[model samples]
Target: MPTYEMGQWLLVMCHRTQQPSPDYLVAAFPTDEIREAYLSIASERAEQEVRHILRAFVGHSRSLGSFDRLQVLSIEALRKEQGREATKNGWSPRFTEYEIRALNHLSGTSSTPTWEGLTWALDLLPHAPQKAIDVIHAYMYAHAQVLPDLRISGLTDAAELIRTRYILQGSASIETLLELILNLDSRDFEYLVAHLYEVLGYDTEVTPAQKDYGKDVIARKINETVFIECKNWQGHVGVKVISDLAGRVSMEQATRGIVIGTSGFTEGPATATEIASRWPSRISLLDGIELIKLMNQHLGSEWHRRVERIIQSERSRQDRRPK
Candidate 1:
């Protein structure tokens, strides 16, 4: 016979719609024997018995929603399933077993996990390995679409800063990092700029996805407040985009303005310089090369290699898919 420890039996309850809800609970049993005993009785009773058990363990005061499905999984089996799902989703720098354990610990009774919890969980792990930051990145990237509200909290900004610093510590060259950044979507690129500013000792905030008012990021360092616009486009950033940033800077009475373009500015650096000179407040233009240089100045040069590998793998996966 096999033995089981506390929290070995994972119970997951979901609403009838198959969507996870707060009313639906996730509870763990102490051992497999206890779980089996309950299941044997549960199989003979009506579904209401499960609700009674839930209310007994938790509290009857809390309202319970109708859950048509219940899943029983061992913690070990759940970890393996999550690992497979993460790999199938092309998550890079996959979460290690320790990281997964930390995540499970942090989730506790909550059905939804927040970015702050993820960051805190990583810190609490034994030995405090730095690769844990990779776990945060992987989870966020994989669940970004499914959990749109995950990034809403300020704590996530701090986590992003920490993750960015770790990435910067890698040996990837500035050129390679630039290429990797260029591959990011527009929203991610904006968030990356905000994180970079945070690493540079500035307090940064990425504007909401909607109603940004021409500014994608706001960075403040001491008395200096900078308004930034990010362009992840392949084509040159034209005068119009630069002009709009300048307008936002002036309107907000900001200390300065910056336009970060993955592609070079239209008509080259000279044109960008002339455009900035026209603005009332100082305006800095950072092309892809200049942006990478700035990033390399603060951290190690090698992290982009890992990111490149992940990107290439994703591309290969896509290529294999039927059109």
Candidate 2:
């Protein structure tokens, strides 16, 4: 794939019409060119993708300017709201700079259709548009690591820094890994594997292998079985990772297997395929992104609050330390 300038990103769309899409969409291209061009495009979405370095500054940041549906307070108002003084309503806020950052990350960026919209539409309609979702997730994964303008003096906590990126962008992938382990329901494995199948719009449940099988969860859909092994891996999951999950799938006599982990796949696709080929059924793959999609498909961003609560709880535990 070809890279564009700082202001543009490629939103890949397939069409059955006249021509193939070029490398990217950019405002630099001429209007006459657009009229003659065969591919659909949006330079605006591309520009919005990278405009925010800090997750907290996406749309509502006074610095970057305004976005739709959200009205930001003036600097004087914010200053007072930050507890510098009291508002006209006789209210003084306890909003720290960090919390301000957190607030912005929760809001959506420009030209992006957030899950908030999807949820609304799902309330009105039954199913989400398949293509729109794919496009949304692709854009999400593309810009997933973007940071908001935290505007801090220096970088000290790298984990927090990366976590902040996902926090603002509403990325399920990073939320799945690299931040916090959430929903340790003990039943989470059953739900996660079940939900993975659910995301694919299928019926699923645990099988006998789930009871005596090395696999913790078994999914059934349309006469197919997808056995799953989940681990809350904090770091990279390697060949041994694939092998262990693969073993569990074999014992269960499953048609397929999936190994879910919070970390990244240590081996490349070819190696993964090679390992999967050694087994009876092909083992499918899912890293952090897939896991997040499963969450969004079933749990939504609401799940993050539980993860955040865990963080807060851990922080509280640490805070009880003696000086």
Candidate 3:
């Protein structure tokens, strides 16, 4: 038998007899090491996805403000079930039928799935050497977290008990995309700011630092300034947020103020125009996904590592937990 095939046999034994690595035959699952490995892989996968999604979705190299509308579509095909594919405007180039089937555990129909196959592909952490069963088990474990318990407990339509979650539409919330732009997280934020900053050549500092301000963020270089207020809240951000931030802008020795959030401006463009007429060039807006692109552009690979590390750490911790 091939080495990997041999490993599967060993894994099966280990799972049945519930033994550790050396002792293959066991009745219980090796939840600890498996979880750890799964998390490690997941963390790296999240970074890759973030980068891929940003580069692909934030296409045209245009400033986020330029886009008329943004939507995320699934990369997995109609047959793949609930696989949410794109984030912003990103898409996966391809996937096999079997892969798609395995990825659609939560999805009963092949018409449209919710999660993504890529997430399943990344389930195995130290998967350098493994077998189909091993991969399937890991897939089951991951899927079990979201799907009904019967999935892993072995009580569902076995064929439909596939092993993945896919995103159907990956669009960022209209409001939150803005928050990303005003505040600096990485390349995406930096990229947007670089362009905006260059547009007016405005430079001025915010009096209360982001940490001290207890809200929003600001940056400057010359006499001009740009104020940023980031909000991760759901629903539309009302005039209150903008008005309060405006108050802060007055306090800051800056030129312009921008409000950002996943929810975005509560007021429509017309209202925004009216407000802008009242306080022209005083404040602007950006939401979630937009924020990500700007940060990716500005910060680039630097923040990529940070994102990856955060995801990886979270996964690692999840893995270490007892089943």
Best candidate (score: lDDT): 1
Cα displacement (angstroms), candidate 2, residue 164, comes to: 18
Candidate 3 lDDT by residue in tens digits, 198-293: 323443122233353623334566675677665556566666767766677778656777776655555665453245445667777776665544
TM-scores of all models? 0.41, 0.38, 0.31
Best first by TM-score, ranked? 1, 2, 3
Each prediction's Cα lDDT score?
0.54, 0.43, 0.40
Arrange candidates by lDDT, highest first: which order?
A: 1, 2, 3
User: Considering summed lDDT, which 10 consecutive residues are worst modelled in model 1?
Assistant: 63-72
Residue-level lDDT of model 2, residues 22-96, one tens digit each, is 423232221233322312222112323322211221112233323311323443356555554454566667653
Clash pairs (backbone) in predicted model 1: 170-302, 170-303, 171-301, 171-302, 172-301, 172-302, 172-303
lDDT agreement of model 3 with the native: 0.40
Candidate 1 Cα outliers beyond 4 Å, as residue runs: 1-175, 268-272, 305-323
Report the lDDT of model 2 for residue 266.
Answer: 62
Worst 10 residues of 2 by lDDT: 151-160
Judged by TM-score, which candidate is best? Answer: 1
RMSD of each: 22.5, 19.3, 20.3
What does the lDDT read for residue 153 in candidate 1? 28
**Per-residue lDDT of 149 in model 3:** 39
